[model samples]
Target: MSTAHDRERAWLLVTRREVVSRITDKSFLIGTVLMVAMIVGFIGFTAWQEERTDEATLGATPEAVAMAQAVADAAPQVDDKLEVRLVELDDDAAARAALEADEVDAWLHPVDGDWQLTSESSEQDSLTAATRVVVRQQVLADNAARVGSTVEELEAGSTVGTEFLRGDAERAAVAEAVGFVFVFLFYFAALVFGMQLASSVIEEKQSRIVEIIAAAIPLRHLLAGKVLGNTALALIQLLVYLAVGLVGLTFTPYKSYVPALSGPAAWFLAFFLAGFVALACLWAVAGSLASRTEDLQATSTPLTMLMLVMFFGGLSLDGRGQVIASFVPPVSAVVMPKRILAGGVDWWEPLAALGLLAAFALATVWVGERLYRRALLQTGGRVSLRQAWSAAE
Candidate 1:
């Protein structure tokens, strides 16, 4: 005699119970704390790396002044306080000897028309390329001055110029970061929580608790409620993690808020939610299909492969070939946002992508619920998608 509304309310109550049970668990609280700690530790590590050391050892010979002057000419921005030591090396061999003896980090030699720069692998990070640039510019400037030619004339000798056809520097950096972060987070969060969904369903089935619940509630309602409960749990965890990460970002020294939230950022946030819901529904269906926790590994393989494809596909954004990928549901949430962050996407791209993403999400959840109702109560064996679909008849 109970109405559909009554059944839905009962189902919601079950979901609420599950959510409450999970949200209050000790492991959940501990995991949240550890996540915060890791964020703080990462921040500290970056600060330490930036502030730790500044060491450079420059070696010279009879050509030391010339070489230094050339470097200075190439890059006039060199710090005046940098120490340029003079070494009276007899030849290239003597310079090599000085480097071998740790007397200098790098040796400079004036070959016939060019300078031979040598440094150990250990000195690579410390040695700035500006040293070589300054030297080259200084040499060119000196020659031009001797010929009574202007610096402008000297510059005209170099015809090559860099061009950016699409976006500016800020946009480019944002796009790169967004693409990498979006793909990584989607892949990571889906795998971690998707497995939890599968395992939870299988556990309930194995314990025979689900069979008892099915007696009072329709099998479809029971399965939908379970998926809804686990999804709520995942969303709660995701929000908490996002809040902590934002706090960490505020404390850290990142300078690009414009790209982080503007143009592509807003669009990305919209699609990411749709993408998460769609993927989560599929994960729920995956959970319902498995008969035991052990079967989850094999059953969830398809979802894992799909996630991997979406993730790796986003990596092609650099080549501007991810345009197609940006329209796909799960992939688009990550890819389109990245393109927007990078300033490569048109304003309408997000709107179009979100529309498709929403349709997919709705369809997936609808189908997932139907499958759950049909397969959840089936005992002693796993239910294939084909079997679950046919059960409606």
Candidate 2:
């Protein structure tokens, strides 16, 4: 009974209402504020922890100052810049007790003919190695001068200058963390909110709203409007969070506190937006399959399972996913970004992945519209993925 004009107006009204509700909703605003607060609190907590640790270990002692001066006087590399500490224990038992208690970074004692170094189990290897070199050189010079040996005879063997061929350790570590966070965040967000999109569609359909919609307008317009409306809502939420994060980073106190927000951050944000759009359309279609809100799990289980596979597969991207994973929609979001972050993939790789995902998402939206039309009128029993696909045909 409704005219095309009436149906078009109805669709617009529904979509506008959704946009307004999402943007102005009390719960959404509160949730956004809480998320921002949590992020800022985490950053502040980590800095406090690091500062306390540095304060505990980096201080000077009288005996340590004397020993450090002696070592510095012997070796050029042993500069007096380091804050050294000493725990002058009466015996090895006392030293062992102090080490067990973690009261010092290192302890020096006289061995049979040379000095002995003792420290806690968790002492930094690099610091310990540097200390040993300084002390050994000083001992060697004193012994050699007593026996009239040459400087060359007392000098230790040369150390190799190791060069990495494929990757630097710090770079690799940063790349891996960036990749992991991007992939995981993308996957989880898609899976969680994507299902919400699906359920939203199914609820409207079950209530006979789609029938009223279909009587006046084409099925395609109705479906497209719904998907667009939901996608807009999700994007608005993401942008707000990102804006809060950027604002927090601008403060000078948080200079070293922010995540590396340079090249990788930019790329990761781009990929995340593209990936969200690609997945959200398909999820909207999945939501249309259910006749009732309770039927959602039955209809959406396959897509949910696919999302899970993509999530777990992302964890192994650096290890197992080199070639085969770069093109599979959900999994590709994780894998391709990982390769790019690792500096292991070409620039063209992300383009190819995005292209594939876009194509797949469009195809899914088409199929989903057909299913939405068919199932929009059916209710009472469960609607399965097979039934939805067959209805689309």
Q: Whose TM-score is greatest here?
A: 1
**How would you encode candidate 2's per-residue C-alpha lDDT over 1-393 as one tens digit per residue?**
876687767657666766776668787678767866876775566446534322113112333445545543443355333434444455567666766777756666655765556667666554455568777766677779899995567554765566655477656665665566666667656775687677767867777776776667777666666666666776666566555555554553444424544555566565566667656766765666666677777666777787778777877654555567867775676777777667656678778887887777667666666766666656656666567567643
- Across residues 108-147, which tens digit of lDDT does each residue of candidate 1 receive? 6667877766775564443456676666666777889999
Best candidate (score: lDDT): 1
Number of colliding residue pairs in model 2: 1
Please state the error at residue 392 of candidate 2 in Å. Answer: 8.3
Question: Model 2's lDDT to the true fold?
Answer: 0.63
Score candidate 1 by TM-score against the native.
0.82
> What residue pairs clash in candidate 2, if any at all?
198-287
